[model samples]
Target: MRPFLFLGTRAEDLAADGEYDAVLRFSGLAERDLRRVRLERDELPPLDLDDWSGIVLGGGPYNVSDPDDLKSPAQRRAEARLADLAEQVVDADFPFLGACYGIGTLGRLRGGAVDRTFAEPIGAVTVTLTDAGRTDPLTADLPGSFDVFLGHKEAVSALPGGAVLLATAPSCPVQAFRIGTRVYATQFHPELDVDALCTRIEVYRHHGYFEPAAAEAVKAAARTATVTEPTRLLARFVELFARR
Candidate 1:
């Protein structure tokens, strides 16, 4: 079976590795089934879509809404590469799932309005499925309304043209959406479980998701919150796309 590719940009090794592990854990994929490429550490390798079952983009600290002048050289380079790859992925309606930071990539490509308008605080939020979401193969099996872990500095304020809204939270309207039958993106971290969330809380405590002093509080909250439902999305994606 062809492995799925996971693209990530976390500069912190611990956070980066943890994100990949969480994805593999939830997707029910073995190390051989899921390969990773760290965008921050190196250039995006030349990709042949047919060589992999699908692609998954993980979350990161960079915000697509940030001004060009403010972006680091690495951020600029990563965005350029992602934009190019996203064009091909979306055009083909390839099996792709982007969590958190993905909404920005696919959102912008489809002409969605992305900004800081819907910044959600660090914690869990109730995500509701839209009518389309209720029927989408990837999300239909999830509860009509379930708790998801999320914390974003910016979000897609408007749904992209031709995109279908899959899931939404009161604070973040575009919790999840699909560009076509196969391309998908979510504003929340479906890869995150309780332990994974805590790991990030510590690694990114000073990265501004929350007050550094509130690190313990944020972690405590994550430990107490029940955030299990979102992981199903990962499993469903793998089930639908894994090539034999």
Candidate 2:
């Protein structure tokens, strides 16, 4: 199988490897079968859907619904590129899994409203799979409710007509959704665990997920945060999509 294309920004350190590590941790892709393209730092090459098994988009700081003026040229380009790729993915019902920010990018393409009104902060929260989620191919076996790490400032306010609402939480109505047979999105960090979330809480403290001084508390919360079996279903996602 061809290498799965891992698209997203470059995390200076912990994320330096970007979704590569996440994919490794959660998917069937080995280091050799995964190739990462940091859209923030590199000019994305033309895409050929046949070149890989599937596409996996990681989370980022950019919010798609934000004003155009607020988006950097790099972000704009990245979104456009991803949007173009999304159309192809949707057209073929290609295998795809988008985490966190991936929801906004694909959600926007599917005519869903992406906004900050329902944005959730960094930490762990119980995500209840909707009836649709309970029946979804990806989430069918997941518990009705489970704790998963999350850190987003935007959510799907209105789902596109054909999209299935896979998961929801009191904090954010659209925790996860699916556009087609193989395309999926989530507001939670399926790639993250307690130890990983604490790292992000510390890095993003001053950046705003919580009060600057509350980093410790947030870290504590993350430490005790529960990681559900469903979250690791993302690995199964990789096994199906990335290793095809």
Candidate 3:
């Protein structure tokens, strides 16, 4: 295996480290099997699917639902670059696991309607898997319902043409989806756990997932909620994708 590539975009250094550590812990991947690429102050070489076994994307404060006028030039450039990156991932049906923000990036590329209509604040939510999602190779071993960590202001309103809706909650109709055989996306944070999420709530206190004053409450909620089931599913995804 070449390595599992991680692409992250969090302007804050604290947020960046939390994202990186959560992914590594969830995947249970050895350092040799993972290569993280931060897009904030780094340049990405052209994506070559042949050289990498899989790609993973971490969540951030950025939202695809923001209006173009509100986006800075750098943000716009990053979006375009991600689009170009997804082209190869989609065409090759490259093994991919995108959590939160990556869901918007991949969803937009696949013709899914992504907006603020279904935003879930910081907490754990119950999710039911669709029949197709239940049958997906990555999710086959999981139960029909499970707890997942969520903190976002946007979600997929409608799945794309060729996508298989994997999971859903009453608040967010599209919690997860699969593109082709290998590409996958989750609106929730499958890489998050109680302690890890608490760390994030501290770093993202003002990112607007919650009121600046309510950050402590959010952490308390995460501490009491169950979010490990989803993280295990994410680990299984990376493990199985390596077999293809």
The most accurate candidate by lDDT is 1
Clashes of each: 0, 1, 0
- Tens digits of lDDT, candidate 1, 86-158: 8999888899999998988888875678899999988999999999999999999999999999899999998
- Per-candidate TM-scores read 0.98, 0.93, 0.95
**Per-residue lDDT tens digits of candidate 2, residues 137-217?**
788878999988888878888886689888998989888888879888888877776766776776666666678998898
| lDDT, candidate 3, 107-201, per-residue tens | 88656788889888899899999998788888877789999888899888878779888888998889889888888899888888788788888
- A best-first ranking of the candidates according to their TM-score comes to 1, 3, 2
Between which residue pairs do clashes occur in model 3?
A: none
- The candidate 3 region of ten consecutive residues with least summed lDDT is 235-244
**Model 3 lDDT, residue 165, Cα:** 87
lDDT of 2 at 5: 74
Model 2, C-alpha of 228: deviation from truth (Å)? 3.1
Candidate 1, residue 216: CA error in Å? 1.1
TM-score of 2: 0.93
Which residue ranges in model 1 land beyond 4 Å of their true spot?
none
